[model samples]
Target: MPELKGVDGLSEPLLRLYSSLAGENPWVEFLTVLRRQLHASFATIILTPPTARTPAIVVTPGVPDFEIGAAVKHFSKDPFVGLPEGRVLTANEFVGREAYRQSCFYQQYVASYGIEDIMGLDLLAKSGFQMRMRICCGAGRSGFTEEDKQWLGYFVPHLRAALDLYERFEIEKGEENIYDTAVEQLSVGSILLDGSGAVIRCNLIARNLLEQRDGIRLVNNRLAFSDTANERSFRDFLRASGPALTSRISFMQAERHSGKPSLGIIARRLTMPPSLKLGFCPAIAVFITDPQQQAGVTGAAVANVLRLTPMEAEIAASLANGLSLLQISEVFGITQNTVRAHLRSVFSKVGVSRQSQLVQRVRTSVSGLIVQMSSGSGAPRRRSRQGAPLLHSAGAGQDRPQVKQTRRLSHVP
Candidate 1:
């Protein structure tokens, strides 16, 4: 790569671009700064090539939305198509100035947009994905020179690396969203905690549980039990489950107000996946199950898993929640006989005979096993029907466990 004079001026903008691509700032702002640094009238970064099926992602700051739309719609007419990848090409190289002025592409698209001189560099192309950077000078400005091309060449590698990093970051974000959505759909409340017992990330159910303050709640962004004794024990348990050392899964019971059933909590240590080592993912996954709350599973999941009708799935879900025939009838606004008829069909499809059997089967089959309360100890026990326990034992409690720890163990600051 040819070194450009006064390259120090590009350092700040390059750093900003890297940060923006990493998702810290807006990407358009970086593009605007980049266009100014190159002294171009307009600049664009296209992620996808102009094709019939896939729409290209053209990022051009300081350009009107209507012009952007027009450019994308007529992108196939772009003069830079089929150019050598990773090589900078000037408009004049493709066609003589007089010939280009008379071409349909120039008359219909380029002239209307006031674009006079164009220069583009293909940044990357792999598989079906392609990315390119283009800079255009208006009618008033002169065409890009050899010095301009050399300056852009010096930063091509940096732009490529930044784009790759941004792509990975987007993929990770998408995966995180899917994981969060799945967890939120479950009947169980999921809370992700860091090494310091502080709440890192949580789903909708967990947020609702915290807001309700039934048994567990958030105190200064840290997980806290309503009961002082239970809170102390829980804090100690979290402290012992640091990332440096692997610890056994722990179970704790939170006492609720009134005569309602106590909340069941199952905590297990989780190691950050190698791909997410640079992000803030919790080291501990805590599942909370309230006995008073009904088992809620999506009707679609039940239908797909058991191959039952929509009505049958709804009836089965009601049965799984320990609802009686009369209660199901009242809830569905149907007669008791109609309820029994649906129940029979549900039982036949689910391979169960009695209501108790149907409840047990649906509870275990559709939503996995429930956390049953242990007889001797008040702690909740995770019992999977497949004989694979969801959580391990917490081992013996320590007399004096350290509480304070780092918020993020593996994340890059």
Candidate 2:
């Protein structure tokens, strides 16, 4: 391995590649820039290991899609695959010029693409994963020189480091996606705003509420209440909740839409370490709650809390939604008589006489249970009334007498 010399000219392009890798630039653009720097007709980086089912990543610029497809189809037979790991080799090293011109790989794949000679550097191989870089020249052009190979060799370590950094960045982005999804499922709408009151991040629920434009909306990327006075006050509250301040403010904004309750907005300044504050983190978090929005109750809560069977829980959940016995039977594909029987059993267990009483009881008891269940076990599995069998314990005979008094019922008469 010769010392890489006269490489000062390559510094700018190399730095651009590193910066692009650090940001959100596409890999193909980086490869295109790299190919121009190498003065090659085409450039590619491949990660293919013997034990791997497929290539992990393939970046090729200035290569036709058909040629790439053909290359993939015949990759096992390519002479480059036989090269020693982490070594630089030219096409002529594997075959003489005459033999190369007569080879099947050259005629079927390389020739069709007008590629005559290839110079490849096997940059790294670890745990059965090999990473390689290749530069190719067109037909009738001179092959890659020893200087070119040495120049690429010098940058192999930096390329490996950049790739490792990219992988870590991808992992962190995936974790951020998980966090965003979890927050979106929250019952309360959450919005993160900068010091200037511009929205930095918001969950799906917040987006939906903004779309409704009933009480609040996004104006010029900032949260705005329907009322001008409320909007002005909200903006001032956000400005006060800056990084230098630790304050909490709560306000109620009346809904412009009829029959909807006013929304409760709570803004709290986020406390962060000095280092984190320097990273442009949001200064305030706003939680919005709409009292008119119906709360979701999972059937699993009814089963676990009320000690009902899965089928009974399904019927009880439907009843809690103010569904008529006939409607519940239609929805579950069961007879109305069967629905009535299930309803009677549910009323006995829940200590509720009238349908309204049952609905109120279930709603009040299970409203807060959704947050706990979603946070702990996620949404409950919905059971099919037709497919799920009614479960009865042998001890039911003893517990039936105390069914109405077993649990302290809520909103039951």
Q: Pick the candidate with the highest lDDT.
A: 1
| Per-candidate TM-score against the hidden true structure | 0.66, 0.57
Writing each residue's lDDT as its tens digit, candidate 1 over 315-361 gives 87777656788888898899999988988988887788998887777
Question: What is the overall TM-score of model 1 with all chains considered together?
Answer: 0.66
lDDT comparing candidate 2 with the true structure? 0.61
Q: Candidate 1: lDDT of 9?
A: 64
The list of candidate 2 runs beyond 4 A from truth reads 1-8, 22-24, 47-52, 63-68, 82-87, 94-104, 124-130, 184-190, 201-205, 226-257, 261-413
lDDT of 2 by residue, 272-380 (tens): 5667655666766777777766645445556655667777878887877667888889988999999888889998999999888887877665544433322323222
- Which ten contiguous residues of candidate 2 have the minimum total lDDT? 404-413
Candidate 1 local distance difference test against the native: 0.61
**lDDT for position 321 in model 2:** 65
The collision pairs in model 1 are none
